[model samples]
Target: MRPKVFVSQPIPEPALDMLREVAEVTVFPRLDRNMSEDEWIMAAQRADYLFVMGGNIITTNVIKANPKLKGIAMVHRRLPVNNSIDLDTAKALGVPVVFQYPWEPVYDRIAEATCDLTIAMILDLAYRLIDADRYTRSGRTLQEHTMALMGPGVTGKIAGLLGLGKVALKMVPRLRALRMSVLYTKRTRLAPAQERELGVEWADQSDILRRSDFVCLEYDYNPSTHKMIGEREFALMKPTAYFINTARGRIVDEPALVRALQNRTIAGAGLDVFWHEPPGSPEMAPSEEFFKMDNVILAPHNGGATWDARTELTKATARQIVTLIGGGRPEGLVLD
Candidate 1:
């Protein structure tokens, strides 16, 4: 008998077909949202492998309900937190949970999205693109507009990256093409050869803040990094500098960011994630203040929401599922 796989959320058709070849696939009927707690527990009880996505809460109750379950495959691009899946429960149950890796196929798509958002934020702040669009739509022309909205250009500016990870590494060439010098700060410094190849200068967080025309946060979120950027760090930035964050929101203090924007301490901001993300509601943003601010660009925590990225992530998850089912330990095993 083929192993049964319960998918708690909808994935691409190609990945579904891939899993169908090796397992009896049972997908949650709803494609627009995740399954409820009861539904999730019921599904877990029925399947040998639970394939989950973001927003599905896999608690200890679900794990204990299914003693015959083999493992779980999570299709998230970032590190899975306890809210998504209770790793302690899975560890206690001796069920391995596999997560997606940054070196996998979906990293490029995420990197591209991050870079795109960073540029969009810069252009919007520098030129007031959103305001200009509103003016044009309201039957106004350049002749009627004054020089009040004129802002700085991006060429020959300094761009700072908080982390030199995969996303930040991909952003280097793009920043260089704009004739911008890139400064990066990481826990461990890169080799001289690598720095030369990527055309990035190593700097501490304070130096990056003081020198950069644009400060981009690309670091991972953890206990050490939580609230790393607060009022003091924001105060270090040049008044004309723009801040961009495509990584986790908890890395920066949201209230402090709101205060900075309100006071114009920093020029503007572009944010993709938030500290308190309402479950299954992608339309929600950080706060009402961000919605009213013209200097800010807000996304629904979906920087990597491109179709290509989704397909690639689904494929990667399918590969991991197949490997686990075939008695092979795949990469990104959360328990081990």
Candidate 2:
């Protein structure tokens, strides 16, 4: 008998077809919205493998219901599997859960998006591009807008990366292309060859915070890194610096960020993630004070929502599932 696979939410057709080739695949009937926890458990109980997507909560009860489940795979980037899955229970049950890491082509798309947002935030905040466009649309001339809005240029500036991971590595060339100096800080320093190749100099966190014209957060969020940029870190930043976070929101203290902007401690910010998300959810407000700031540019955490990235992520998830079913160790296996 072929091994059974259950997909808790809809995925790309290509991945579904791939699973079908190796296993007996069962998917939740609805593609428009996610199934309830009870529904997910019901479907999961019958399978040997469970492939989950965002919005499905896989609790201990759900895990226990599926006695035959050998593995679980989360098919999205940045959505940590531990967030939804009961990792401790899975570990006790001897079931391995896997996630997608930002690597190679995966990092490429996300890095490109992050770089674009970083530049855009700097330019938008400094030049007041949105306001200028508004003035122009209201029948103002270039001279009036230029004179009123004296924006800063990006060339010959300093940029800081919080982590020297794949995304930061990919950003090196782009930052250099604009004639900017790059400083990075992480727990472990990169090899000398990597430093020379990427043309980045290692700096202490405080130094990067103090000297950079643009400070971008690209690190992973965990216990130690939670609220890593709080009042003290924000105080260390150049008052003229523009802050950008395409990473998780919990990494920065939201209250501190708001205060920084309000008191002009930092020039401006471009935020793609927030302390609370999916704007307008009961968890938080969609139009918070940040939305009121002309200096802040906000996106709905869509930095990596491109079609190509989504397709590739699904394909990667499919590969991992196949590997696990074959009794091979798949990449990105989350250990408890």
The numbered model that scores best in TM-score is 1
Instruction: Residues 17-130, candidate 2: write the lDDT tens digits.
Output: 889989999888775556666876887778889888655667788889877788888765534334566788988988888876534666576566666666666667766788
Cα RMSD for predicted model 1: 3.9
TM-score of every candidate? 0.80, 0.72
Runs of candidate 1 exceeding 4 Å displacement: 1-4, 22-39, 45-48, 65-70, 77-83, 91-96, 101-109, 138-149, 190-197, 278-285, 323-336
Compared with the true structure, all predictions reach lDDT values of: 0.82, 0.78
Off by over 4 Å in 2: 1-13, 16-49, 54-56, 64-71, 76-81, 91-120, 123-150, 188-197, 277-287, 322-336
RMSD of each: 3.9, 5.1
Give the Å shift of residue 249 in candidate 1: 1.3
Please, what are the lDDT tens digits per residue for candidate 1 over residues 27-65? 888755556677878888899998887667777888888
